[model samples]
Every structure is written in structure tokens, then in C-alpha cells.
Target: MIIAVVDGMGGGIGAQIVSSLRDELPTYIDIYALGTNSIATSAMMKSHANKGATGENAIVTSSRKANIIVAPISAVMPNSMMGEVTCKISEAISDSEALKILLPIMPENISLVGLENKPLSLLIKDTIKVIKKEFNIK
Candidate 1:
């Protein structure tokens, strides 16, 4: 299956997601890193994503072909600037037929690590469970 992971900058949450997926998911699954910037793409590539692309076109194109799309719930907002994540990217992903795995915590104006209340690892585990169930991964 093709899984697309969207991120804005090259650090924090997005990088962690890429690492977790690379370490936990089977190698058979295709992981696509879709980043708003080159830095984000590089980070995910370091985590071993099968492919990496950046910017608006990359975001739209990857989301269109993915079987699953992963991002934080904050990505839904249009005004995010922490990593240059825009509303257009979020809208395209949301409009796609791909299954979405979204985290619960969304900070108003801070880095992802500063977002209080939710543990990212736990959210990732939960998301993995959903992906496994939906895709019937063993």
C-alpha cells in the first residue's frame, strides 16, 4: 500500500512520524514523504521513506495517489506557518479518497512538541492500529 505522510518543517512531529513508520511498519508498504519544504522531505528520507517530494505540487500529487494519508489534526487549519503548511495542502488531502489518520492535539501558535495534552507516540500507535485494521495488515 502507498502511504503518504505530510509535514511542514523538517523537525519535531513530522520527523518522528517518519521514523516511527520506518521502524514499525513492514518494508513492503510504500512510504511517501510529502513535505512543504525540502528540509521536511530530507528528514523523512533519513527515516527511510521509499520516496520524497516537496512543495505544493508534491503535496497534491502524492495525496491523490496514496492509500492512506497521515498528518496532525492541526493540518486542517489554513493559517499554519510553523512549517509552512497551508490550507490548500490540507484541503487537497482531505478531499482525496485516501484514509486519513489524524492526531488529536493541535496547538494554536506553537511548535508541535509544545502542544500539550497528547503524547505523540501513543497517537502514532493508535494510528498504526487503525491502519492495520483498515488495510488488514498482519
Candidate 2:
């Protein structure tokens, strides 16, 4: 399956997610690192994503092809990541048919009530658990 891990800014969150997936999931599953900038893309690539792409167009294009999209909650919000996430990027991701596995982590401007503010490492671990459950992987 094609899993797209989207991120922006320093891409630290995306890198952690990719790294955890690489360790837990089978290598045959394709991991696409979709970044809002070159630096973000490079960071995720270092985590061993199967493929990497940068910019709005790359994210928009790959959103259609991905079977699952893993990202921070801010990824679906326009003007997020200190404006790294554009309206088109958010639109393309939100409108995609892929199952979105969004980590409940975002900037101060947005908040999801009732969700605990977990640490980044815990959030990444939770993300992997969700993916494994969805894919029925042990």
C-alpha cells in the first residue's frame, strides 16, 4: 500500500513517523514522503521513506495516488505550519479518498478538544498502532 507521510517546517514529525513505520511495517509497503519544502523532504528522506517529493504540486499530485495519508493535524489546515501548508495542499489532502491518519498535534491557533496533548514520541507510537490496526498487521 502507498502511505504518504506529509509534513512541513523542519519535517521532524514526519521523519519520526516514517522511522517508526519503517521499523514496524513490512518493507514492501511504499512510504511517500511529501514535504512542503526541500528541507522538509530531505529530513524525511533521511528517515528512509521509499520516495520523497517537495512543494505544493508534489503533495497535490501524490495525494490522489496515496492509499493512506499520515500527518499532523495541521497538515489539513490551511496556513498551518507557520504558513508552510497552503490552501491547495490542505484541500488536496482533505479531499483525497485515502484514509487519513492524522496525529492530533498542531500549532497554538488550532486545538482539538478532548484529546490529550501527548508527547511527540508517544504520538508517533500511537500512529503506528493505528496504521497496523487498519492494515491488520501484527
Candidate 3:
């Protein structure tokens, strides 16, 4: 399966997701790092994504072709993180037929690490569980 992890400039959350997935499900699945910039892409790629792509075009193309798309819930918002993820990107991903596994944490106006509402680690774990259950990834 092709799983695309999408993120913006500050790639803390995205990197963590890629890392966890690499450690947990290293074989069979293909992870594609889709970032809004080079920094985010590099961070995720370091976590063991098979390939990486950056910028708007890459995001759109990868997301469309992905069997599953992973991102924070904030990615669905148009003005998230000072508009780093524009409406167009969000809409394209959201509107696509691919299944989107979104984390519960929303990066509304605070840094990714600053959020005290929900533990990102748990969210990532839950997201992975859901994906595995849906795809029957034993």
C-alpha cells in the first residue's frame, strides 16, 4: 500500500508519524513523505520514508495517488499555521477519494508541541490502529 504523510514547514509531528510507522510497519507498505517545504520533507525522509516530495505540486500529486493520506486535523483548515497549508491543498486532499487518517490535535494557533489537550503519541498510535484495522494489516 502507498501511504503519504503530508506536513508543513515545522515537521515535528510529521517526522514522529513517519518514525513510528517505520518502526512498527517497515515492510510491505510504501511511505511517501509529502511536505510543503524541503525541511519538512527532509525530516520525514530521515525517518525512513521510501521517497520524498516537496511543495504544492508534490503535495497535490502524492495525495491524489496515495491509497492513504496521513496528516494532522489542522491540515483540513485553510488558515492553519499561518496559511502554510493553503485552502487549495486542503481541499484537494479532503475532496480526494483516498482515505485520510487525521490526528485529533489541531494546530490552530499554537506550536505542535505546545498543545496540552491530547498526547500526540497516543493520537498517532490510534491512527495507526485504525489504518491497520481498516486495511487488515496483520
Candidate 4:
């Protein structure tokens, strides 16, 4: 299966997700690291993503082909990631048919009501649980 992990800024979150997925999922599954910048892409690549790409076009294109797209909630918000995520990028991701597994992390100006505000590590664990359930992983 093709799984895309999208991120911007420092890419720390993406790296964590990639690392966890790499450890938990079968090696046959392909992990694509899609980043808004080279720095972010590099960070995720270091976490052992099978492939990595950067910039709007790469992200927009990969989002469509991925079976699953994992990212922060801000990925669907225009001008997010301190402006790294453009309107087109957000639109493409939001419009994709892929199953989206979004972390509850939001931009500073946006707030999610009743969110438990868990740390990133905990959120990532929850993400893995959801993916395993969907894919029927042991």
C-alpha cells in the first residue's frame, strides 16, 4: 500500500510518524514523505520513508495516488505551516479520495473544541492504531 505522510516547517511530526510506521508496518508498504520544503523532506527521509518529495506539485500529485494520507489538520488549511501550505496544496489534499488520518494538531489561530490536547507521541500512537484497524494488521 502507498502511504503518504505530509508535513511542513521542521518536519518533526512527519519524521515521528514515518519512524513509527516504519517500525510497525510491513516492509512491503511504501511510505512517501511529502514536504513543503527540502528541509522537511530530508527530515522525514531520515526516518526511513521509502520515497521523498518536496514542493507543492510533488505533494499535490502524490496525494492523489496515495491509498492513505497522514498529516496534521493544518495541512488542509490554506496559508498554514507559517505559509508553507498554499491554497492549491490544501485543496488538492482535501479533495483527494485517499483515506485521511489527520493529527489533531492545528494552527495557532484555529482551535478544535473538546480535543484532549495530547502530546504528539500519543497522537502518533493513536494514528498507528487507526491504520492497523483499517488495514487489518495483526
| Residues 84-120, model 2: lDDT tens digits | 9999999999999999999988689776789997898
Off by over 4 Å in 1: 109-116
In candidate 4, what residue range of length 10 has the lowest lDDT sum?
129-138
TM match of model 4 to true structure: 0.98
In candidate 2, position 18 carries an lDDT of 93
Inter-residue clash pairs, candidate 3: none
Ranking by TM-score: 4, 2, 3, 1
Single out the weakest 10-residue window by summed lDDT for candidate 2.
104-113
lDDT string for model 1 (1-138, tens) is 899888875546777887888777889999998888888788888888899999888898888899999887766667564747677787888898999987765666555665456588988887788988888887
Considering every candidate listed, which one attains the maximal lDDT? Answer: 4
**Residue ranges of candidate 2 with Cα displaced over 4 Å:** none
* Residue pairs with clashing backbones, model 2: none
- Which has the better TM-score: candidate 3, or candidate 4? 4
For model 3, residues 1-138, the per-residue Cα lDDT tens digits are 899998887777899999898877748899999888889899999999999998878888888889989998777788785678888788878987889998866665655665456688988888789888889887
Better of 3 and 4 by lDDT: 4
Candidate 4 Cα lDDT to native: 0.95
- What local distance difference test score does each model get? 0.81, 0.93, 0.84, 0.95
In model 3, where do residues sit more than 4 Å from their true spots? 109-116
Per-model TM against the reference: 0.87, 0.96, 0.89, 0.98
- Alpha carbon deviation, residue 9, candidate 3 (Å): 2.3
* Superposed Cα deviation of residue 1, candidate 2 (Å): 0.5
